[model samples]
Target: MTASPADAEAPLSAHHRKKQPEQVRRALLDCAAQIAAEQGASAITIQAVADRAGVTKGGLLHHFDSKQALLAAVFADLLEQMDREIDRTMAIDPVSRGRFTRAYVRACFSDRLLGERSLWGALSVAIVSEPALRSLWSGWLDSRMAQHAETDGDPRLVAVRLAADGIWLADMMEKAGGLKRYPQDFERVLLAMAEG
Candidate 1:
């Protein structure tokens, strides 16, 4: 048998083929998220996601059994990313009440998290399907609120927390002019609350 020029590319092709499955799954999630961002949750179906991901429907199903599973995976990925960010922030800053709160608020309002429509849809699906997850989310927020209350006796901390949450909710809902209609002035309000 004689070797040809195509043989030289065989190794690279094999490497790509080996890694392509994971890449496809990632692409599916990313594309689905983008579609959800632009068109809303109704656009995030298995067929649409698979088509967007450029994979066969069978391939997508192998990664996610159902739409709910896909949504849960998305939420899990978002939370895991948040945890990594929180860990990084903690490593850089001393663990003070104010520092912790400020870092958290900064992280929440950071570009990575702001106006993340996919995460909101995923969170909504997860919350509806998994009550425990809802409790967990609520518990985390409540704990943070309690911590702020302990550090700052002002009732305004609750309002500040709620205001921050309102920002998130508005972003999630995709309500027109939400941010402009109820601007929270995050930096100014958060600093006053956390500094106290």
Candidate 2:
């Protein structure tokens, strides 16, 4: 027999239910990240994230107590992804000196991490404006630097990293203003600098 409309609308069995707490939380974070990447940080409202994730506002709140809290969590998640990317890139480098610096430069230029329309582009402003977010980023940087001090502590390597930061800032500005200021081979130059 065919199922009735009411029966069809009934909730699935426990085994079939996929919206576990952790899954729901991940969905909420993914939705929030998409909104930020597409429309900038100002567009990430609780209601918008809830709608995008197919959850109620209350459900979103149950995962994140406030909008600021949600933003911080999103920022932290991005940092974690970046850390993993850096490690993955570092592993392939046979050079001992400046390996971490080279990996960092590569990660910054990676399309997956900081591409033209990446979440980092959207959240850059928030990182500067929000002290808490800035602190989180600073802490992450500090820890990474400490961990890689032996390999990446040379002044020349530090200069390479600083140059990479400048390139990143320029790229962000180019995205924001539609201006092509940096040359195409900037990454190559930075990588070469990291080598020496």
Candidate 3:
């Protein structure tokens, strides 16, 4: 039997069919991030993200139960992917100094997952709004703080951590005019701090 034109036009990939769920999940998260980047997190409604992703609200719900869930997935995916990329970059340490810490600092500013960082401020606000998430995030932070204090002999470890976060947050909050501009030597400053 000969195939019709419509049949010929059908998608040609079994692999793509198998990956549909992952693709849909990624699309929804990307759509939410784009919305946050464009109009802030308050603009990130389920309907809006569903429409942007070219999926029905029901379709979106199949993957994310609520707006918070979607936002959480987006934020978590961003961090996870950033960690992977930073780890890869850190593996090629030419300077051979504070390899892991420098990679983390680099990841904070040079996140390549999302183009604009407006989503970061949105996610930060979201993380604080949810108590469970807030606890998880703070506990993770506390552990990192402890590690920093133990590794570095500096008595001002708290100040160092806050300053590093301030530098990164300044860049991330650019859309909100939180910081007019990161100083020209911002990365250098962070790198120097990473070394200390």
lDDT string, candidate 3, 16-99, tens digits: 555488889989999998888777777899999999998889989999998878877777776667558766976786755455
The models' CA-based lDDT, in order, is 0.64, 0.85, 0.68
**Pairs in steric clash, model 1:** none
Most lDDT-accurate candidate = 2
| Model 2 lDDT tens row, 61-115 | 9999999999999999999999899888888889989999988888777763345
- For each candidate in turn, the TM-score is 0.67, 0.87, 0.71
RMSDs, each prediction?
4.7, 3.7, 4.7
By lDDT, is 1 or 2 better?
2
Name the candidate, 1 or 2, with the larger TM-score value: 2
| Model 1 bad stretches (over 4 Å) | 1-20, 111-160, 170-174
Q: Model 2 TM-score?
A: 0.87
Model 1 residue 71 distance off true place after TM-score fit, in angstroms: 0.7
Local distance difference test, candidate 2 = 0.85
Mind giving the per-residue lDDT tens digits that candidate 1 earns over 1-196? Answer: 8879888666664336655667777787788767766676556789998888777788889899988777656555566676677657756765455555565665656642344454554355446557655666776666655655655335565555566666666655554455565554654667567657
lDDT of 1: 0.64
